[model samples]
Target: MKLETEIKKPSHQSEPDYVTGKKDEIKSYGFECTDCGADINIDFQRQIKYNWTGNTDLISESERTELKKYYGIGLSEKSHDGGYPVFDKIVCKTCGEEYLTYCGVREFSNSAYSIHVQEIQKIK
Candidate 1:
């Protein structure tokens, strides 16, 4: 079972009333490798939050493939509560590993000296 801490927020920001009112927008661009194939072409996207929520198709397919070959994602994040945005997850799909509360977006943005650099570096 997945364990989660009871996250508390400073200010209350009402939940976003999505048009669909459900988990939507699933944009996942990566490889699916098993003990069989080298790397499967797993390039797909949907406007639902089943697998991926805030993720988008920013990087190209070619770039995504290359990224999977090199530095693949260790985790993904989304808005857990109505406080603010945060990178509160790290999941290793290969080993079925997950880590939460590793990063706080608000804290990072507030202290990041090279905010511009971070923006460019963090995103594709």
Candidate 2:
């Protein structure tokens, strides 16, 4: 299937905020389809694994805090190859279309970092 044209790609603000929030964050999400304007709810289970280059010591304190917030685990704890798992696909029940969103560790300037809402891709 083709991407629904109505919904625009989401920015960082749309990411799941749980690490810093007081209330327990729910992994499951509910939102309206950007393409069809239909209500959609998706239950997330860890599906992808990311491996970073260096350990947590490479980043500054502020970056570490941000990383933990987005990734459930702190940078110090991330394994060399096993970063974090995230929801890989959100299937809209109303339209039967799939959208992709995930957070993973990346190597930059010899340091591993977490990126939220990496990309949104339509799937057949």
Candidate 3:
């Protein structure tokens, strides 16, 4: 897969605020395909794992630190328990564009999941 440049946010937004906003709050959060501009919902459970091997090379040092602090867990640390610190490769249902998304799951009754997508890049 060929790696493309990082996705840029709109001029009005400072950071990728959509990355942390709830799906209900942000209508286009994590749904738009960067390549095709298709609105495709991401099914985390059904999507194939990216088999990241816990490599932090794809992400910047500041992003790695921010992710760890926000998630309250180390990105490279392995959990004895299952289901956390998800790093998966997801395909765009419309254009077949692949993306490597890093996410942190909150183990509440509802199990909130947030994707850190400031640097989400397309993979060919």
Candidate 4:
């Protein structure tokens, strides 16, 4: 089978929902082994950096006022949730070569987000 066909779902994952706190989850996929041309399974964990876009509907009016006073913007005073993914290591089952993968998204919003595989490095 092809690399994409071998892995059906993420080996590690998270549940995402705007209402509940359990929103962040890792995305996993597969790739062809660079050395041996065999299928490889990879896993990734999402990361959110310094950006904070808030949900005003969830916060109280007082909180919103305080956030606007501090930041000069009407925000929920929260870090931007739902970021990119970074894979620690993926070992090719066929050739035993290790790799480090870095993946990211273009934007994260209340409506949707985009995901991209940024870089892949061979470690062993």
Q: How many collisions per candidate?
A: 8, 3, 0, 2
The TM-score measured for candidate 3 stands at 0.42
TM-score of each: 0.19, 0.39, 0.42, 0.39
Error of 3 at 106 (Å): 2.5
Q: What would the per-residue lDDT of candidate 2 be over residues 11-99, giving only the tens digit for each residue?
A: 43443322222266455445677667787653332321223322122234554344345545554554223334232456677777676
* The candidate that achieves the highest lDDT relative to the unseen native structure: 3
- Give the per-residue lDDT of model 1 (tens digit) for 1-124: 1333322222224333222223562223223232232332222212231122222243344543343333223344322321122222323345543332211122223322110000101110
Candidate 4 per-residue lDDT, tens place, 1-124, comes to 0022222222123333221123554455567776788977544223222113221223344543543353233233321223433223467887887665433332454635444444455653
> Candidate 1: which stretches are off by over 4 Å?
4-87, 106-124
Q: Judge candidate 3 against the unseen true structure and give its global Cα lDDT, from 0 to 1.
A: 0.44
lDDT of 2 at 50: 25
lDDT score, candidate 3, position 80:
21
Ranking by TM-score: 3, 2, 4, 1
lDDT of each: 0.26, 0.42, 0.44, 0.40
lDDT by residue for model 3 (28-112), tens: 3355787789875544432213223332345555554554464355544532222244444567777788775554322333433
Regions of candidate 4 where Cα sits further than 4 Å from its true position: 1-29, 44-87, 110-112
